[model samples]
Target: MHGPEIVTTLLEMADDGQTRPTPSDAWHLFLSGLRQRFRLPSGRPLAVIAAVLIASIVGGFGAAAGSWAAERTFADLPSQARVEALTRQASPGDDYSYDRSTSAWGTDTTMGALTVSDWDPASARDRFAADGWQVTTVRDMSAGALAYTNDPATGSMTPLPVRGSQFDAVRDGVFLRVTGYVSPGHGTVSVMLWPDDTAAMLPLMLAGAVLGLVAGWMLAAAGAYRMRPLPAGRRRVATVLTGLAVTALALPAFAFYVNMTRVLGPSGSFVNTVHSALNASPYWSYSTPRMLLLLTVTGAVLAGAAWATMGRRGRSTPAADQIPTTG
Candidate 1:
């Protein structure tokens, strides 16, 4: 052919819809390639939804794990030596009658008796403030009870009253409660400490959530792909098992989160807030043995289904049409 004809033919071929892909077509092809490569099942909205729910549960677990791990990075209770030193430095003239220091449930406490001193509450407050402590009078305990009790008239929470000579102090993200009765020459003193480290926890929890989301998505994709060829009866059973497994995982995490919210709510002292934040108690408390048993059984059944269907072919394709045979 002449060069002009050849050029015209090339232009026509380029313009043909089937000859070249548009940007949208290319994007779709790329996505399709990815789906096939990953063996992701398509055309199943329920499977996708189930995967999303699974991911949410897994992501919650990751966040909880991250928060729990982050708490360990901070000291929940101050050292015994530091507690002793603070008491000695705070009241130099007073001699100790008894010294008892203990740690429990995210709180560190020290109590001792003094053989009488002229030190009053004001002086103690000033001393605490001088030592970088933010001092404030403790709130009335009655107010805390009132917060939970039903208010027949208003049904709204009543604010706590800032009364009492007992002091609550915070310093460097650590909380301290100072309580005692002091007179002209005798008294008992108690100091309790709780630590807070929320700054580091937030970032770790976010990272954990992202990781969990990815893992959950991949797992869901794999499960959907594996069950793509399952018979109707077997598929129904598998779907039930999946639902049971998701419920088993979700309930504990939901219960734990709710409890944490309640514990961290505005009702009690800041001491309670710090304790709840650092306690990390719900992981074990909510994940009971019965829940674990349910999860295990569902998982086992699903695994058995997969094993039983191994090496089986999908629904057979219809035989191709054949031309009529000549006599």
Candidate 2:
């Protein structure tokens, strides 16, 4: 029978009170129905098993490839040097040093200190402007510092102003903040630079992974439904169990294969190690586990419902055959 007709029949039997069976009974009947419908070459069952494994492997690898591509794209974003050059130009005579610099696949941030003998906010702003940096605002360090707070409830810290004069600017895609502090004999300029694109890239990476997962599941399901059906009187419970196993195994198998092939080194062995690359992968950490559980439960429930419907149909058929015919 066609996929839709089989599914519809199962659903109708599930909805009909007389035919509705318990979850376990329904699953058994579903497996029996599948066996009967797909009774082709004797090797049909084995082929279905192989198809599920192949589908899962393709799905897992496809997700991994897409995720890696996203990371590579993010890595191509503009670097902090784009802003640092402007800072150097703004404070030519000052001795400059990077206070802190951090980088990830999609983002980079650098904070630098410039030691100068004099503090001239106006001259600094003009210098930055001449170098194509658009001055955003100039404010007293004390006023900016007032915005800093430690939230007791959340235990989160907000940005605090450095001990100096504050200047904010934007050039190209970089956000720059320059703070100048003047003492009796010493003055210091602080430069902070960040790219605007990092904020948007993270969400896109996560979204891409999710989309890949869904596409994989649909492909596997469709392939399974369209394959040759199982033979009649095949062990109903065994068939249902095998389906469940396939559903559960496909995701982890895909995850393991991808992780081992892509993340592990040539010398690396997949022995008794508890750690896996999938666990470390940002995209896979949460999504893979949840998808595995959801798919397994869904497969079991569907099988049970299909089995129950088939059993109801079987019992009703015999009774109908036994009934007296109108002459």
My TM-score estimates for the predictions, one after another, are 0.51, 0.39
**What's model 2's TM-score?**
0.39
CA lDDT, every model vs. true structure:
0.55, 0.51
Superposed Cα deviation of residue 76, candidate 1 (Å): 4.5
Query: What lDDT tens digits, residue by residue, belong to model 1 across residues 98-182?
Result: 3443221233334444433434556777888988888896433323221123356998754432222467777777667766544
Tens-digit lDDT string for candidate 2 (1-327): 344444455555575465656788779978976555433334456654544454554455454444445344432223457445656655654666764432211234567677776677778888888878779667777443333457788899764444467777776666677777765455677777654332333244344445545554554343344332334544454345546655664665455444434432342111111113333224254574345445545654654554443332111132333333457
